[model samples]
Target: MKKIIFSVLFLGVIIVLLMQTELGQMLRSGNIQEVAANIQSYGWVAFFIAIAAVVIQTFFPVIPFVLLAGANVLAFGLWVGFGVSWFAAVMAALANFALARYAARDWAEKKMGHHSFVKNLNRHAETKGFIIILLARWIPVLPSSAINTAAGISKIPFKWFLLATLLGKIPAVFFESVLGHYMINWEAHKGKLVLIGIGLVVFMLGINYVKKKKKSTLLS
Candidate 1:
């Protein structure tokens, strides 16, 4: 049927998009000295590269924003990292949002016909988008990049989406930025910093759980 055909095409596109790049390999290296040298020479240029990666990386299996966000903290410091990560995250979300609103929705509606499980999910995300974004960012399983696309496509309000993206992403981005700071000065306060990140993550999770329960109850 139409659904089967659409599914096949979707799978094919996913396979094509995940093809690896040379740069992706270089950055994944754990050699801190090598990474430091590259940053020392190319720090300014790397900022733009990070932006480009956020825009294009929706295709790849890799989570480019998370990688770059961590890198910003290590190379630039916490405030710089937080700013870069937040900006890139917001820009990428906006791009994905436009694509979903303009392109994917019609195709999805046609293929799924009606009665989709996401019909309700989309409604929730659209109405309480800020909370939804916060929850998605907190939930480790869902890629923040993916959420950007989904939120856009779901026709969530632009203002809500932007607000959610900024506030919601704070927990993870802050944690990683702080984590990088610790790694840089790790011998000083190692255990304490680690505990702090863990606590923040757990607190965010509790917030997400309560929000979900309340939303579900109201929707029901």
Candidate 2:
């Protein structure tokens, strides 16, 4: 527990320092224009840095994925940006899962054991992990880190996780890329974005309701 607290505090200090830099200010502002310009300044190195940013954000998501994806779109254009975001996100998810499953599964299980949600997830993972992962991936509001860590400690097979992640991440990444591209002009897309957000919330609520109903029926 002391080690964990120290690590978190250490990370916090690093973030504070980074925020003082110009690049860090741009990142903190989440101004896609400034971020894209910064990436472009590095020339070809931009690709590597952009991909690395996506990967790193998996473990430390202080940087919003939408911002990164948007910056990629501005720097690399629509299709290439979508490709980069999707590929990097998928790879990042796998890496996070592997780290948890191989290095920290036992520790994480012990820590989260008393949590009812974790127990329920473990039970579902034994039977419906693939579908759960797939749907979870589709919900951009859900934290990818949570999904990856939970799956890593569950009984779900790696292959199933990979396949489901691959299928689920495609549309989600594409949508994010597109959203980022248009978000450059918030006023231009404000109405559409609002509608989309409302729709997503409703869709998630409906999914939850259906899931609960199905579980109740099965129990009865």
Candidate 3:
């Protein structure tokens, strides 16, 4: 309880600071391109700041991460952008998992018991936790924070969590970086980008469908 309170207070302070600062103002402007341009202006320091921003956003979650991923791609291009975004996202996810497991364990457990989606995750954690984590990462609709928190609260091993997170994030982050890259250069690769986007969507949906069917079969 004390830990949770302290964490909340700390987060509150950070939020207040951000809202009063230039960073907060830029975020409030809702201009991804502008933010990207500003980050790019910082030169090499931009990569470090971008990584820190990703980690911070995971905790605060006020900013849409897709915007950050896009900004990284805009500043660093395809390969480097993907690498940075993927690494930062993995780090952020691990941080969230650790925070939930340590600082917020009791609260997270109680909350998971109350929420249906999280409840289901708790069940899967007892069995195929890795697959659950992997699938959750791929499905954009499934909240990543919830999965991280729930995994921490459940009996899933840290190794499985880490492995699943490392693998699961690949496709999603790659897709985000690639899409952003193409979007910026849309005039040249508009058709190819659209096809890639469709293919990714279809692939994710197919994997999700298969997983659901497998689950249903086991239950039956």
- Candidate whose lDDT is highest: 3
How many collisions per candidate?
2, 0, 0
Model 2 scores a TM of 0.80
Where does candidate 2 stray beyond 4 Å? Answer: 1-25, 114-117, 124-127
Winner on lDDT between 1 and 3 is: 3
Tens digits of per-residue lDDT for model 1, 1-220:
5545654565454444334543444444444434434554565886765555444445443543454555666666668767776676677667556655555656545543243323544777656766766667766657665576566556467788788777876776776556655665568968977787797688778878997999899999
Q: For residue 95, what is the lDDT in candidate 3? A: 78
Candidate order by lDDT, highest to lowest?
3, 2, 1
Candidates 2 and 3 compared by lDDT, better number: 3
Better of 1 and 3 by TM-score: 3
lDDT of predicted model 3:
0.79
Report the number of the highest-TM-score candidate: 3
State the displacement of the C-alpha of residue 216, model 2, in Å, after optimal TM-score superposition: 4.2
Q: List clashing residue pairs in candidate 2.
A: none
Give the TM-score of each candidate.
0.64, 0.80, 0.81
